[model samples]
Target chain A: MIASTSIHIERTTTPKAKPPQDKLGFGIYFTDHMFIMNYTADEGWHQSRIVPYQPITLDPAAKVFHYGQTVFEGLKAYKTADGRVQVFRPDANMRRMNLSNDRMSMPEIPTDLVLDAIKGLTHIDQDWIPDGEGNSLYIRPFIIATEALLGVQPSQAYTFMIIMSPVGAYYPEGINPVKIFVESHYVRAMIGGVGEAKTAGNYAAGLKAQDAAKEQGYTQVLWLDGAEHKYIEEVGSMNVFFKIDGTVYTPSLNGSILDGITRNSVIQLLRHWQVPVVERQLSIEEIYEAGKNGKLEEAFGTGTAAVISPVGELNWLGVKLVINGGATGGLSEKLYNNLTGIQYGKLEDEFNWMVEVK
Target chain B: MIASTSIHIERTTTPKAKPPQDKLGFGIYFTDHMFIMNYTADEGWHQSRIVPYQPITLDPAAKVFHYGQTVFEGLKAYKTADGRVQVFRPDANMRRMNLSNDRMSMPEIPTDLVLDAIKGLTHIDQDWIPDGEGNSLYIRPFIIATEALLGVQPSQAYTFMIIMSPVGAYYPEGINPVKIFVESHYVRAMIGGVGEAKTAGNYAAGLKAQDAAKEQGYTQVLWLDGAEHKYIEEVGSMNVFFKIDGTVYTPSLNGSILDGITRNSVIQLLRHWQVPVVERQLSIEEIYEAGKNGKLEEAFGTGTAAVISPVGELNWLGVKLVINGGATGGLSEKLYNNLTGIQYGKLEDEFNWMVEVK
Candidate 1:
């Protein structure tokens, strides 16, 4: 294992001007420097470096471009009231990235080396973190197969990189409820497929469904199981939750569903607050039945980008089921406030979720 | 639509040393020049050019590297006995590529320009075509999302490129039979998924299963359907066919299986010869029963790489089902010989499938 002190740093000579906090959209602009590491069959994982942000050059026959052999992670770094930088659950992201690698048949990266790289790079580019409310430095760490071969087997070489972008809030208009379209025709993933992995192809498979939902005046898509098209799987790439009978319920990790960090945290927080939260197979028909019987109270999605995205309505097979009168429920509002408060260091770190950079 | 005459040409100043024909493996060494074209929302696939083959530069946040918004097609150019170059069914490949693009939410490419690009590039790099038996120049045309954004949407910019490589015979030890492992765990594609498209993710999803089969002393894996592990979908990324009771049977054009050009050609050739061929759902149990009942005659796979791969043994759930006494069947040999004879210009082009390059 390589120590963090062995990391080589090459600062950029020409630094570009930083974008304004208000103008900083989600992932439009990048910082001056980025992190990169290389992996080979003979050398394992070595040659870690923080270099200038530039375009990467690769052969046209690289396996990643032809086979989609890649994995990624997303997390954010926030500036606390004491002017210190802290990231929320980066270790979990690293662990999940390795899980994705194992699923995609790529090499595993050391968690310590990745954590140090993220913190070190975040420290160097601390000024790029936005200071506004619901704003942070969105960090994207990904790995791609770099071998210049077209065979279907695993690649012999790989490249790991991390790029950061400071962005405004996901809901710029504030935490308003979104209308979700429960998709049944298009299957996002199969039970025995690569849907559980945070791989590129899983995202590509959902672009058509999301685009269709957008055209139908829906903000996001709620995917169903490939076999039955009954069980709830995910909501727009995020883990979804439904409140029925004053209890929160989300889909279990059924090999086809991603084990989201925010989803896990929300369950823990709900259990801490003595609110019933269950992780099991919850079908769409049951949810709609509860919605008709006045048992469904609220619905929301959880992810890194949007800490808590409240779902105001769901349209399933031409039937619209409005929740909480198309308004954010009290529990949803409290969970959003508590999670973001802890993330931004506005609340006490009761669970020790925030890890300081220094 | 852009005209084929608008494509600009730039020759390579530094020529690469060509490898020997015996060392020409699949997709390893590329030719000197490549064809490239750009696509944007406003331009709509403009600026076609043939330039020197080199490394391509892309931002770290390019959509292709993150979301896997890419599609590709494969075809081959052969040197006939009369010293002329020709491609086998390139128009079919182009149409399939457009279908893949539509499924991936990418922009469509003009078939006329793409055909021109293939012929034009093959003509320029005609010297790279190997003269050995069963050796040809493999052409890979792919398009990738080039927009450097972290959003999970269809990219606004795309890069389409065609790269050529000389390849030897897929079966180096002649047309010997292979053993296949029937995969019942991993799923390649769902009915409503991107299985029919020649996209990258579907290939990646099969890597783990293929590796496992290799460890178990199998040449390739025969994938089952995603919903139920009963119906046969494909064999090692190729379309499979079974000869039982003097009639050829292949799986129907299910949405979860690729529409192989070679598979279609083989069917057409069989029909032309007045041979019995049927396209329907053929299950593994039915195949096993046929083998036990002394009815299974021959089995083979068809694809661009391997025109026909004869399957002599199938390991299904630890039960070895040997066909034709674990030897190449007469029907398999005839199909392969006829296909190669037509591809190499040794037979009459009755179907006009060969498109010659001047």
Candidate 2:
């Protein structure tokens, strides 16, 4: 593991002008500086630096281009009301990224050192953190295999990088409800696959289904399990939850769904509010039945990008299951408010999830 | 669709010396020039050019590095005995790559134009083709999403490139048998997944399982179905076939296995030779039962890299099922010879599979 003190910094000689506040869409504009580190079999990890944000030059035969040997983590840095900047649960992301690395057969990174680098980079480009409501600096940490070999085995060299983008809210509507389409055709990930890992292929595999959902006038696709299309797994890139009969239910880890940071935080928040929250195999048919019996109260998705996206309707097999009368539920609103409050330093730090950067 | 006449050529001025024939390994050394074509929604696929081989420069937020919205194809150019270069089934690879683009929600490329580009590139770099019993020029055609956006959608911009490498035999011990490990715990791709697509993530998902198999002293992994883990899917990156009771059998294309070009060629050769061939669901238990009854005579894998790799032993759940006394079977050898002969222009072009480059 490399130490944070060993990281070298090189400021940009020509920094581009920042985009307008309204133009800060998700992942559209980047900061002036980016963090990078290299890993090789002989030297382990070295050459950690903060260089000018620029294009990555790689051999055409790099494994990352052909083998998809990569993993990524997404989090956000929020600006407090008093002009302080903080990141929410950076350690949790680092830990989960390591698990993803193990699943993807890549080397595990030094989480603490990477965390310090993240903070240092954020602090250096602290002005890029958007200040308006429902806005934050989206941070992306990723690792790619750089070995120029065509063999299917893991690459001998790797590159880890952190790139920050100032973005507005994930949904321009802001906490409103969106319709979801239950996808029974295209599969995302399998039980013994890289679904739990935040890798590239899982996202690529879902594009066709998402495109179909969009064609059907839905905001996202609610994915069923790959093995059996009966069980619910996730909604787009987010973990899903349903409130039924005054109790909340979410799909368990189950070796497929991602162990999302916002999902965990929402579950803890539900438990703290004395609300019953269960992690089990929640089927799409069961949710449909609950809606028919008027027991399905609310539904929402949890992810780093959106934070919380309320599900107003689920269209499965040409049948619509409307939840909370197509509006954001009370509990969903409260959870979003609380989570975002803690993230932006508006609420008290009960879980100590915020890491402040001076 | 762009035509071959629109292609602009830029030769490399700094041509490097080629590697020695003994050092000619798979995907190691590259030619001086490469084919590149860009795709955008407004422009379609324009700006086709052959330029100097160089590193690909991409923004850190390119979707290829993050979401794996990419596909690739592999084929080989062989220097024939008559001093002419030829390719085997480039059309099939191009068609399959188009299907992969459809599955990944990418814009469909003009296969005819791309085929012309491949031939033109091969023609220009014909000298790099190594002339030996088991040596040729390996060509890799790949497409990467070049849009520098973090959103998980189909990229608006893409780059299609063809890079060539002179290679030696896949196995130093030519036409030999390898030990295979049946993987039950790790699933490759589900029926409704992107299993049939020659995409980057599919290869990434198999690295861990391959590593585990290698740790157990196996050369490759025999993948099982994701739904039930009962039916055979693929052997490593190749398609598998078994000769049992004087009949050839292969797992059917059940939407979960690659439509291998060599597998097609092998089946055609068997049919032309008046041999029985069947493509249906094959169970591991059936293979084991056949092995026990001394009915499993020969087994082999087919792919572009190895052409034909005979399987001498299969280890399934602590049970070793050895085939043909742990030696290469007669049928496996005949098929390999026939395939290589046709590919190298030694055998008669009965099937019209060879495409000669001027």
Candidate 3:
């Protein structure tokens, strides 16, 4: 282990690291150490630390509770075959996080600082990067308004923190298809809003709809544009993808759907594979028609947690469109295989997306 | 002092055996005690408390950190001229808060329970209520997700808290004028979104645009609808009012505008004054043209804290519409005086709006 024998190491104290194999669940288990930083209007971003995971006490009147002034990002670290804990395209996550911060009126986190924090935390939790397919350490970085002042005029104080959680495979027994309930009444995002930003409010807005969808025996809810409820947007927490006519197509990231890291990676991989891809306004009617006409071969949702969750059937307005018979679609299967292969260092790192941690 | 000398009522102590006889400022100070309750999926809402003012410790991964799972209501307590602590139109705030709770998928605080909690806290903080015109104890009741889970699901745990702050009069020196900034780019709320709900996300989403407006010396950002920027929605947190000719015109209570308690109260008072109050789409262009034609007379925004904030000038795209001097308009002064009169018990509580506590 790289210890404080190196320079620039500030207050390094190692804890007894646990094996990465056993995970309580995705967000349930956290690593030993985390990166923290505070930002005040007076002090740009002071008090940076990689401290042990702990609870944060807040004034009951903190603006975040009353104003929803918070944003976050999710990505993961993979345990490669050669005992290397690697992060996939953290730069994209960092950039998107800043986008979320800017949209939410929160201070921007510098790219270098985001990189440094994640690298530092993952290094400290290297043992927490579990091995095997579908197992990894889920890294969550978030920011919140910490001002004690009750009056809301852009909080003068804020806190940014990065916490890591060990996650089991999203699907324990290899990849499989999941059903989705299309939400037409409850819109996920609207034009000129923070739809592209990974803010908590957006997610909170989706919960009730998601709960209803889940109650209808669907694993997730597919969100539609608020303006035109017919336009396809995204799944519960991931970006939607479709494979049609030997080509890959996903909804355009038009200021509403999250610019997910895994979504970007999938597009890049599809481009690398020489498949024609289109990112345009995908409509629900088009998908329903494609499925009915046997042209919609596969559908999936992509994000850091579930690398690619295949959609077998879509329940929309009481109409069911089965993309696959609750089994992983062929193209989805290939995409998942290729993405996981690159993540686990089994395939060549052609794009050099993985960053190695000592 | 009604307190526990054992179980129910032994009259333990009182901070001060009398209420303050001065007008209060806006959200600058608070009552001595507050009420809180918790909710989890396994155990619905439990552990309700009427605790002293204190900070709450939260997990870093709480859903409130990432998803804007938060909402709030604002009302006030007034010490009447007869030394009675009363609240004006409080059920409106409670009902509106429940509407917000439903929009965000949060468990609704029972109406009677809300009354009990508000009564409990106000009784404990009776001394904080101000007994003068435009001066009242501002009460902020808010709910937030507290589940430590990282994934986006309606937080398994939630917090319902009520914190009171002694607010000085919104217009300290009596009715003053506010300048509004018209933005064509950023839209605050959208149709089918949480615009009707008093969710923190709505305010958090608007801070940047609001800050930009303030930087340009504008008091608040006048939001337009997301679908078409032509229609006027609201000015910051308050519901806006416009006057053309002798009839008062306010934007229709579309789902994109908050269902403000003060907005409703103002509507009733306007009707009481025999003024025509039309709730229809009032575009910014219409307001500008009307001002040019000498048809637009006055404009203002209403809320529980601010009560009635007059608009003297509207700065739109380098064109200034000086409807009135940077002072209170005629209609505004009347609304402010009458509304606050009923609040602090200066005027007879006509409409039976005020509920006396002790």
Local distance difference test, each candidate: 0.93, 0.93, 0.81
lDDT of 3 by residue, A7-83 (tens): 12243366645645655476977778778887878768767787778898888878888888888888888888888
Per-residue lDDT, model 1, residue A314, is 95
List the candidate numbers ranked by lDDT, top first: 2, 1, 3
Each candidate: chain B TM-score: 0.98, 0.98, 0.91
Judge the docking of candidate 2 as incorrect, acceptable, medium or high.
Answer: high
lDDT by residue (B1-358, candidate 3, tens digit) is 1121111212224443333435343565566677887776666666677877778998888878877788888888888777888877778888898888888888777667677778878887787766455667878888888888787777667888888877666666667888899887777778777889989888888988999999999989889888778899999889999988999988998888987788888889999889999999888999999998988888999987688989988888889999865567789889988988887777876678888775
> Where does candidate 3 stray beyond 4 Å?
A1-23, A324-327, B1-25, B130-133, B324-327
| Local distance difference test, candidate 3 | 0.81
- Residue range A1-358, candidate 2, lDDT tens digits: 3323477999999988888888798999999999999999888888899999999999998999999999999999999999999999999999999999999999989887899889999999998998788889999999999999887889999999999999997656678999999998888988999899999999999999999999989999999999889999999999999999999999999888999999999999989989999999999999999999999999999999889999999999899988999999999999998999998888998999999998
Weakest lDDT window of 10 consecutive positions for candidate 1 chain A: A1-10
Clashing pairs in 2: none
Instruction: Give the number of colliding residue pairs in candidate 1.
Output: 0
What are the models' TM-scores?
0.99, 0.98, 0.92
lDDT of 1 by residue, B252-356 (tens): 998999999999999999999888999999899999999999999999999999999999899999999998998999988998998889889999888899999
Error of 1 at B342 (Å): 0.6
